[model samples]
Target: MAKGQTIKVEIKRQATPDAPSYTEKFEMPYRPGLNITSVLVEIAANPVNTEGKETSAITYDSNCLEEICGSCAMLINGKARMACSALVDRLLDETKSDTITLAPLSKFPVVRDLAVDRSVLFENLKKVQAWVPIDGTYDLGPGPKQAPQIQEERYPLSNCISCTICMEVCPQFNTQTNFVGAATIAQAKLFNMDPSGSVLKEERLRALSGDGGIQECGFAQNCVQACPKQLPLTEAISDMGRDVFIQKVKDFVSR
Candidate 1:
């Protein structure tokens, strides 16, 4: 890309959560290494539509230009992705079009233009008790050590930034089923495997046993594909599913 060349961007905007949505087009000078977030910055610098009409600066959420923050997740080119890492050149090359499309994640409630409510994922995490149960803040010296093999398995699961892309791409993640989605399942597996977090393993397994639980997964595997961190989502879900089944059996026998 060179100076004087420009990229056309189409953004889906809504003035408020209850307001109607409209599309706004803008042209920004093309620059090398420009990601979707950078394009938004340029638009903020000059909030003019394609018709040359002055407009409100595009409202979007972003922080940590790097992909680590996970707050910049949105639909880029009709797919769930992180705006901070969606490179303009690669996007244009992929579509072979001068124009790129941006929108809020489809499944989430629109908090504002390009920003959606992803609290559902956090709420799901709470449902599964996706955390190690620490009894006290008091310095209890030397916790039980984990084996190196266990550490290797837990590391990738810990990389989940709760971006909710996995949920966004899932077909089962809708109001009808109220499915907890794969992120919650993956996190359940993560904490359940922990040397200390395993204290809540039975509770986590029980939590996943009923409606909106692991059984809701269609196994489309979209979650694994859409995950920015390349987590073993399917593997975690499978393991959790097996564990949940075993937990049910154990409960039945104990009765």
Candidate 2:
């Protein structure tokens, strides 16, 4: 690594959803500890391709420059990852290729360049009712106490940032299946475990039983591997599956 070395990036670009896609190469001055977001900012500043032709700035979603926002997820060197957390040095070291590649997440509909419409994840969340039901702002007394043991178990499931990396890597997540994927399942598990939130447990279980629910998961285990927050997705899926099964049995008996 020498001073004045340039970092090469190959970005897949599309003007609109129906437009033809193309790859444009960019060269930026190498800087220590630079992330992919910073590299895209450099491209935006110049808006010139490697061929030195004037081009439009790369369109991508980014905010909270930190990894907490989870809006900067993209394919970096053929992997679904958060651009804000992906370090250039580590990426270069792993691929051993001078050029870095950026592309939109494959499982989602591309809105522009690297920014794809991730609203599907939100729609799925709505289907599951993944929150505690509460009424007006009237003061409710102290809620039921949860044991420390329960809190410890539910803590890891709450770390999901909804980045959809799990959905991207999942084999079951596609147009044909409409599988909700692991994040929503993990979230359902989180709420179901809560003392106050579990009031809707039966409804949540029924939601997971219908089309595009937990049963659609193929258990390829890709979600667990792809999750940046390291959530216990497989375990949550297993637990939720069991709960859904029990609810089905109870409903059958009552009917």
Candidate 3:
């Protein structure tokens, strides 16, 4: 917390997906208002370990440094959070220690260092068809109007940056369970609420009725708490769960 003070960070590094992971210690001079991304940048520029050994630049992903890109999500102090907004000062204060631990999200395959393959979330979104169906071949006239209250509810759900923090925090999101986690479910809810998008409502509900679908959610509520955008994940999950159930009943009756 003073001039010349240094912060110790232990980073889990993997050169490739199949490579073994190991920890590298770094000591960076303390800088006020420094976030984890900035620290990584400094470390990259120096590429030196605590023992003064030359090392490769840390491999990671970052963009928009403002938490919008969601590419900076990683395990900081054993918690999934956006490194761009993970303030070093706050991390130190919380841990009450000089050393901070960094690792890739455990739920995904490690690409390298703090980077992991989050393509699973996107694939899940594809499964749910999380989008408004509009063929924009030509200018379609004005769309149906939505009430202000509807917008108010949908706005928060739409803020999902696809960081996969929800997936990372979810205990149900593991290799054994095909659970899609909270983000995809929230996006399904978001699109399903749109007046125009509601045309595909039944399809979306049916999509969520299958394997690795809404019913797979264990409701640990960790996704809601860990979402960087504070999306109404639990609410969306509950709504989608009910909808999925109703769809199943309707399907049974129709058959």
As a TM-score, model 1 comes out at 0.97
TM of each candidate vs. truth: 0.97, 0.97, 0.97
lDDT of 2 by residue, 23-106 (tens): 999998888898999899989999999899999999999998887888999999999999999999899889887789999998
lDDT, candidate 3, at 122: 89
Residues 1-255 of candidate 1 have per-residue lDDT tens digits of: 567888999999998899999999999888889999999999999999999999998888898888898899998999899999999999999998889999999888898899888888889999988887777899988989999999999999999988999998899998789899998998999999988889999999998998899989999999999999999999999999899999999999999
* CA lDDT, candidate 1, residue 6: 82
Instruction: Indicate the TM-score of model 2.
Output: 0.97
Give lDDT per model, in order.
0.92, 0.92, 0.92
Tens-place lDDT per residue, model 3, 40-100, is 9999899999999999999899989999998999999999999999999999999999999
TM-score of 3: 0.97
lDDT of 2 at 232: 96
Candidate 2: which stretches are off by over 4 Å?
Answer: none
What is the lDDT for 150 in model 3? 98
Model 1, which residues run further than 4 Å from truth? Answer: none
Q: How many residue pairs clash in each candidate?
A: 0, 0, 0
